[model samples]
Target: MKHSITMLEKTALAICIFIALIAAAQPELMTEHIQPVVQDILSFLGSGFFLFVNFLLFAVIILSFSPLGGRKIGGEHAKIEYSNFGWFAMLFAAGMGSGLVFWGVAEPALHFMNPPLKQSLYPDRLASSLALTLVNWGAHAWALYAVFGLVLGGLTQYSGNSGDICAPVMSAFGNKLSLRKKRGVVFTIKLIAVFAVFFGVVGTIANSTLLISKGVEIELGITSPLLIGTVIVSVLFVTYTLSAKLGLRRGVQSLSIFNVLLAFSLLIWLLFIVPVAPIMKIALDGTGYYLQLLATGTWQFDSQLNTSTWATHWTYNYYFWWLAWGPFVGVFLANISQGRKVWQFILAVVGIPTCVTIIWFSVFSGAAIEWDKLNQAGILSAIKHDYTQGLFVFFSQLGWQGTILIWSSLLLLLVFVATSADSAILVIRQLVQNQFKNESTLYVWCLALFMCSFALLLQQDEPLNRSIAILGALPFLAVFILQLAGFLKEFVRDLCA
Candidate 1:
């Protein structure tokens, strides 16, 4: 109830600064040491990651349809805080916006040209490619976030004590963990969550800068890293900073609505330009292939699959990326999801967002595939040179309107990044203070985030930033396992009570 900063908060601040400074000082060296470690980690935990994610997807689906789904999140009489559109917009924007834009066209094109499985395995490479893209951005990713959000929201709501990510978990498992051991575990988990958020957000900031700078290059032809970083970072910092200050209800919600609208507009415009029939066909075929192959594809690392290298780079990489972002997005989603029924919450969180993502990728990727059939492979060639160019290249095929489309996309990209950034800053601030509605320390957390992200942007090493994020997530896999346990315990207890 009172605003106070704890020692854990101070430690989180200090650690964020320290990591940022080190990353700035030795980006290459850091990447060199970290990449191999993360590579080995991916190999070791690859199958487990797949299994855990699949379990989450199935658990969410089963629970949504079972008797438990009828339970309201806050309480039966609790007031709905945000309108349905507002809530979905905020969650979708915070969780998936930037990454969706960044990879929308590029990933599908890449997979088409270089199918993860042998070409002999799938006759329709375009469908297979789109299916793989759907797998990455689809229900599985949302299921992970939904599970975490449900656990965090349920424990906090039922126990009536919500602080950092660990507080509710501690409340759930209190009797089992000795006080001394509980303190240690809480510290460890909180620390891991903080670091994971730091790396995850920093990676996003860096990648967003890369893509936005690419847009600038296309329009204005300014290519200096310093100028581009300063311009983009300054604009984003000012934007999200103001948004964070305006608080969640006003700023985040407004930006999210704007973002979702703009995104829909772009999707619609693309629909007109791109061939509609082929896009529809691919969407249906891709959805079918994705559902049919979901089980086997979940375990792409099996010895018989013989696609370890491709799977490791594509499927496994996406799982780890989503895992890294799980807690951050989970916290944001849980905060916004009060007063909804369990079934409604999971359905909206996992189902609706994924449906939107499928349509988005189908439009963008289907266009690229159709174009490649006629353009002598120009779009894929540009994308291969720079993945960020995929969106621009795809737009260029729209004739004279290409320039306007390109600028509109750049605006969409920035807004998406801003929404994600502001939400993350708010969550991190709450984690730092272990309390909600405190604005005194908002700028401190924001500055820390900007520093890390700015440092990475300066380095301009997207791979390095990504590797660090994946590494940050490695420790939290243990936390996720514990969260699953805590959630089940809380759910059963709630039913009995």
Candidate 2:
């Protein structure tokens, strides 16, 4: 037991160090490379893949109402059920909370200002711009979450095991190795999964830290902002980790509930105080354009005429960003999702919330566009200059009351960032220790915090994007291999059966 514990500690340390080094080396590469590949794969997989998978699982659920996939395997029914509240809460948390909050307003406005290729889709560039935003957020974004959640959740439930979430890929790669002789295969797969998850969690931590810090700096005029922000975030994380260690149902669930309420309040304020009708009109128009584009433009990866620019800026960047998020968020979602059918899981976790996100995008994005239209402030240009300033520009449009609302919303954004970071730290601890119990793992949490701080510090003088890009790229090839193996195995097993 002593030797085993020592080995585990050493392994955890090694993993942390390795991730820190990668983060320090080139942070943007992951978003540049691996993400685009994942997107391409999903484009090929199509949204129907998730819909069909859910339908098949729903049939199975109707037949069994148990954990059995037609008696090939069987277990107890899930303790969790799909409800509107549960669905929305989980979606808000898992969908990168700040992205929705920050981008909800920013993304549509950005698109409206700079329409993507093929402006002819809309009557004018503004309509086309809104449409582009909706397409990216509504279709591509949700499709990823749905596909990953379906596959990960289905496999986890079916196996009735709590091994690393990447185990299903191993099962997919069956016969490629002699499992009897190659125990190292499992270890390697787990290591890769853990590493991929680590990189993702680190990126999330850095992003959240930056956002929260900026929010604080803006709201309070806090000088030495990074120091103040870091200290505050550290305190919050320490408090959360303590609670999480107590238990998931108690600390984690309570925090999640609080986060939801805070975020909801912000949304309500935006919906009511902001011009609702115009936003809805913009959103509807955006959704239409997005859908039309989704049918035709999702797979446009032209390699010849500077496709890299587009891929780097939009497609690949978004793909990598989401991929960077996948393992940590995927594992978190998988853990909470129990006693649920695949179809229900997909709908609740991925489908419905994504629809809600569209509404969010419309409100926030529409508000920004309205501000730009009314004020002629070039909100998009300000965001490009400094994304943080965009919030101030937005607040200015709301007038004096808008200032208060924006401040409150900024606080909410800080909370979202804090909640996301806390959850990520917990998930990383679980990954490092190979356990999911809600126990305080201060060593891992502190180590994660340190690594994030180090990454942030390093970024003061250097570009971290390349490092992120490289670490990010490393996982896609493995995921692709696993995905291919999974498809082949499914085909073969069905044929043989």
Candidate 3:
């Protein structure tokens, strides 16, 4: 059994490397072909049916937390405090930090400039442009996370299984078949988890490296910004991985807390120095539009005359991107979420941070948009040039105080990247150990980090994201299907009983 397990691990690793190679070899073709498939799957799954199911699940959770239903679920008997604030902090760092920090200003401005589908809703480039920004960032994107967390957490805790998040999908196979009876099932689960994490880590490392490289290139005339940035990120990832290998209590948790504090400081700075009234107005209008368009915007996939392109670019791309990050983020979330109830996990992981993200994006991105409108500046043009450069340009427009914002933004970006790296490393450790709380888990995490950084360097223009999208899309669909099946099965069983 031990030898077989070793062989299985080796095979999984080989498959990951092979996929990485293929992605590196044919990025454009791979992206063009694979992205459409991901879009179709996400479109199908993210349609009205999926939305209705998610709403039902949310209602169930709300009811489950009430006094009457809480008693039924043994919520009253539960002894833990649930650490609501800690949960929020961790969830914020895990879910939105990397992407928000990178895209908060850039995304809104991009939408404002291009207007994904060139929809006639915002014929005049007024504050309404901010509405579309909030729509993409706020509602459906976070809704998916909420749904995934609720189902995964509920299944793990309620079913009294091993409490591994990935177990639910695996359990969908049932204990009947001979294949399920063998060790192959365990190997397959581990393999899936491994691939998922690899996909997320590589994409993140590459994107973050790209951002940092661009930042350096703008600040200093570094001709080989990509190479330099890759090396720097590789080094930092190695260091963080070593820290992760040192164990969560000592390394991962500490770093996460620090990252949160840094992010908080940045927010505080923005609020105090930046004008707030415009941001508040933008946020309010954006939130209203988001609510109005939530239902209609989700399924607006028009293939003819380029109507679907916006859905393809904003909604579908966002959906697949989130799905790509799901496995690593899900596994990492599952690990930290012990001793907490499913309801608590769902709310903490998905709800609070989402609200916070809405506010954060509004403040940062909205302020930039407002600044541009007031000054009639070319901030939108900078965003058009490069999404990563937009944030710096927005900061620069803030005057002398802008320097402080730039430095703070840079630091915040680093912290966010580090937090993500730490989590990815931890997830990698968990997969390799095949058990939570292993003493040598940190070592395995560091090794995985090294491998991720290596891939980032070797395959700079690799369609690593395409591979991630494909691999993540499969298990994501599987998990969604299993959750639906489980919900239906439980509903029927309750009806009969």
* Candidate lDDT values, in order: 0.80, 0.56, 0.59
Question: 1 or 3, which is superior by lDDT?
Answer: 1
Instruction: Give the lDDT of residue 497 in candidate 3.
Output: 62
lDDT of 3 at 91: 60
Query: What lDDT, from 0 to 1, does candidate 2 have?
Result: 0.56
- Candidate 2 ranges beyond 4 A from true positions: 1-9, 18-76, 81-84, 154-164, 179-181, 223-225, 232-236, 301-308, 432-442, 457-470, 487-497
- Number of the top candidate by TM-score? 1
- The candidate, 2 or 3, that scores higher on lDDT is 3
Where does the lowest 10-residue lDDT sum fall in candidate 1?
155-164
TM-score of 3: 0.82
Whole-structure CA lDDT of model 3: 0.59
Each prediction's RMSD over C-alphas, in Å, is 2.3, 5.7, 4.2
Q: Among all windows of ten consecutive residues in candidate 3, which has the lowest summed lDDT?
A: 67-76
lDDT of 3 by residue, 217-242 (tens): 76666889657776667666665766
Candidate 3 residue pairs in clash (backbone atoms < 3 Å): 245-442
Q: Ten consecutive residues with minimal summed lDDT in candidate 2?
A: 67-76
lDDT of predicted model 1? 0.80
Candidate 1, 1-497: lDDT as tens digits: 54677777788889889978887887776767877788778887877788878877998999899987876665565557899999999999988798888888898898887777455555688888888788878999899888878777654345443224775567557588788998788777877887887788778888888988887887788768678877898898889999999989999999999999999988888787767998998899888878866767565545423366656666777788888887888888777877788899998999998898889889888988788777765889898888888888777777777788788888998999889889888877766664345566777888888888888887777676677767678898888777777667666677787
* CA error at residue 176 for candidate 1, angstroms: 4.2
Which of the numbered candidates is closest to the native, going by highest lDDT?
Answer: 1
